[model samples]
Structure formats: structure tokens, C-alpha cells
Target: MRLKVDFHDQTETLTPEQIVLIENLLNKAAEIEGIEEGSEVSVSFVNNDEIQEINREYRNIDKPTDVISFALNEQDEDELAVIGEGIPNLLGDIIISIPKTIEQADSYGHSFERELGFLAVHGILHLLGYDHMTEEDEKIMFSRQEEILAAYGLKR
Candidate 1:
């Protein structure tokens, strides 16, 4: 698939290798989700303060989150129509808190790369209409996340 990833590193937390790893993981995620070719996804790395502001503004949660997704296609009929017309599918934006990622990695006893990949996959799944709001949905979404991570060699 023609997956176009636009990466914005507001925080210089990722090395070149880690950046490449994230892109590869996201591409694999799109493939697994059966996303159409020529789709586009945006990934942004930000600090805790920036993410906390975004979290509060968008989700009204007054706290920093590890990741946040803004799905462009969800509930947007015009966007869906463009996607159906062979245009590049604008999947959505995935904003990640680099500091939060590091904290979670240490707390969870995993590599930063693994945690980053997990968050990226999680955000992408959300862009693809996956949610963990209910128990059954949580089971399905978490299982898929693990499977995708393992396949991409980012196992926990």
C-alpha cells in the first residue's frame, strides 16, 4: 500500500533508527487493517506540557495522555467520499507525548521503541475505527495491538 507518513518531531526524542522503526510499524499496521493504498497518516511527537494542553482542550481530561488520535474519516461524509474516489485516504493524526512514552516504557519495563510502537499502533487502530470503550471491544483491540506488535518484532 502507498502509505504516506508525515512525521513531525516537536520533541527530539527519537533517533533516526527509532523513527524508521515507527514508520515501518505503522505501515505494517495499515496493511493488517486492510487500509487502501495511497492512504496518508500523520504522526507528531510532542512534550508532556504540549500533550497535556491538547488533552485538556480536545478530550477535556486536564491530563497528559501517551497518545491521542484525531480520525479524519470518522463521521465525515465528505472525506469518505474522497477516499472512495481513489484519492489518498487521509486516515488521521496520531499525537504522541514523548515524555509520557518514556515514563510508561520504564514503568512497564519495556524498551522505549516498543512503547512507541504500541502507541502508534493504538492510535492507528483508532483511526481505523477501533475503540476499547467496552469490555469486548477492549479485548479485541488489545489483542490486535499485541498481535501487530509481536509480528513487527516489538513484543512486550
Candidate 2:
């Protein structure tokens, strides 16, 4: 399935190659998850300050986070579908902190691209309804993340 990933770089620091990597990584992840073709997801890059403000406002947290995801299609199993035929599913928005990506990459002793790839996949999985509130859930979600990232050649 072809997933359309729209990116808005608030930090404007991503190289063309980084953008392409994110797009390709997300598409690969979608394909692995069996997401339908034409589904749309948006990813935005911001600085620590902006991400902190967003985290404060949305999540009641005052600190900056590495990434944040806003899922658009979250629904219960019995919820009725409102989307029409041929309409691409509006998956969600993912916001990443450029500074955080750099910091985390350095802290983890990995490449910047690897950290970015990990954040993008983590956000997309959140949009896909994967959560890590519990140990078991974290294991499930994180393993899936590792599987996708390894398949995309981003390992650490």
C-alpha cells in the first residue's frame, strides 16, 4: 500500500535525504502493517521549545518530548465508520523535536538518521493504535517497532 506522508519542518533543518528517508521509512512501515493504499499521515519537525509548548498544552506536561503523535482515526471497535469510499484515511500528525533527535542520537551512540527513523516509526505506531502503558504492551509495540526499523535498515 502506498501511504502519503506529508511533512512540515518547523525547524527547517532536515536535509532532502532525511526527508526522503522519513517518507520511505513510513511507507515501509505502513506496508508491513497492511495499511490501505492512499492513507495520509503528516509529520512535523520542531525545536525543543515548540515541542515543550505543545507538550504542555496538549499533554499537560511542561518538558520537551522527543516526539508527539496526534491520531485522527482513533475509534472503538463498535464505532461506526464515517469515512466514505475512496477517501484516504487521515491517519494523524507526528511532531518531532530536532534538538531532541540530535541529543538522543548522541546519547544512544547512534546516527541522527537512526534516531529520526525511530521517532517517526514510534509516532506512526501510536497512530496505528499501539500503546505502551503497560509492560506487556510496551514489549509488543517496541518489538514491532524494532522489526520495522530493522527491516528499513535502521538499527542500533
TM-score of each: 0.93, 0.95
Error of 2 at 10 (Å): 0.9
lDDT computed for candidate 1: 0.91
Residues 1-156, model 1: lDDT tens digits = 458899999987689998899999999988888888888999999998999999999999999999999998777555434434656789999999999999999999999898999999999999998999999999999999999998888888
Off by over 4 Å in 1: 76-80, 83-86
Candidate 2 residue lDDT tens string, 12-85: 89999999999999999999999999999999999999999999999999999999999988878999877888
Point out where model 2 deviates above 4 Å.
76-80
lDDT of 2: 0.95
- RMSD (Å) of each candidate, 1 decimal: 1.8, 1.6
For candidate 2, the per-residue lDDT at 136 reads 100
- How big is the RMSD of model 1? 1.8
